[model samples]
Target: MEVKDNVVIITGASSGIGLATAKLFAKNKSKVVLVARSKEKLDKLAVTLPNSLAIVCDMTNPHQIKKMIKKVLSNFGKIDVLINNAGQGYNSLLEEIELPKLRHIFDLDFVGPILAMQEVIPQMRKQGQGAIVNLSSGTTRMYLPGMSPYSSIKTALNVASHTSRLELAEDNIRVSLVYPYMTATDFEKNTLKSPRLSQSASENKDFGDLPPVDSPEKVAKMILKAVKTGKPEVFANPYLEKGELQV
Candidate 1:
């Protein structure tokens, strides 16, 4: 989809990959709507980008999402693309993971994106064309031992993207999934983990053995390119020797 002169909504746009993507879109002259819990960061970013609006929204809250969509439509009149990039990590054994943490992760990783899609699709259908880029994880295919909880939720999102893509095709609303290999973002530092678990191994592994973590800027560019090209899926920093994903 052509981004110039279009309205693009990016969740988790306060920092990391979302922020990078928002900047790229803004550079292309897209009217950008930045959504995240950090009002200060959003406000700061809004000033830096031309034609950008920062909205403080907690994706887990349906009411906030409703107000967010209402506000976006009120300001921009239409949404051309929705980037579901609001998610976090939980690195711990299933047994060590608390029930509350599990529920929170599920809500943030899966339920929230589903609700955003529900609210945006109608507008897209009316417009007769739109694009949705959901951020899933590369770990979904790798299946790391301690990251099952986090990866599983993202897997559900991938499935939803696939189904939504097929269902929304008649309306010309394209849904794409982005699997970003470990990116050098603050995501891990912000992740929920137990105090009891030893962090040494995980911390060392993060900086060393795992596939080279792509920069947020790099991933952001790939995602935007995929949206422009109308690709259904994009995998960043693939682990395979061929380093090319079939999709």
Candidate 2:
């Protein structure tokens, strides 16, 4: 669970929680591998961190993930921690949501990480020790009107986290799930990218009111701390700590 000297792989590390965790790990003197679709961004970030490797990977593709795992194991020797955090949400009413868009959410938020896990776990298991940290949302505990699809897939991930934990524990591998409250990131921007949605909301569309969000950097720091301590679940914002915010 120590952050120092560990080889950590972070999916979706181009930005947001993934990027934050990469920077935190590098700062903690860990060897870090960052995976994302943006080559330029990953290159820039890799140059800034010592003992870090930036890999342009699309987790959705099984081939890309396989090659990524090959490149990591070849370069860094092994991965001690795998962070599955690349996901997007679909925030729309059930009636307005198209079937394709709904499926995309399930694929990205659930299937993508699962594929990455399947590819990397064997290497981790071969080493006889590893840790997995999954990114989840608080919407799993509450029904946010416009988030039916998003919450559904996220809940599926939460369930995967639990079952995967029990299954992987026998191998001396740890699985940790984090349900971070809304943070100031590109989550909504990514949500609007559902290909199945024929009619999209205007860029300025307002969704009445929602809970206040926090900074990605703040949440990223909390995420690293939680992982280092091996906590099963960590609330970076702890919005539910207050009675009114309870889900």
Model 2 C-alpha lDDT versus the unseen true structure = 0.81
lDDT of 1 at 104: 94
Model 1 / residue 83 / CA error / Å: 0.1
The per-residue C-alpha lDDT of model 1 at residue 10 equals 96
Q: At residue 225, give the lDDT of candidate 1.
A: 83
Write one digit per residue (lDDT tens) for candidate 2, span 40-120: 999999999999999998877778988998899899888898888888878777777778878777877898889888877
Error of 2 at 49 (Å): 0.7
| Tens digit of per-residue lDDT, candidate 1, span 1-247 | 9999999999999999999999999999999999999999999999999999999999989999999999999999999999999999987887798888888989999999999999999999999999999999887776566887898899899899999999999999999988888788899888888665546445655445656668999889878987897788887765622343333
> On a 0 to 1 TM-score scale, where does candidate 2 land against the true structure?
0.88
Residue 35 accuracy (lDDT) in model 2: 92
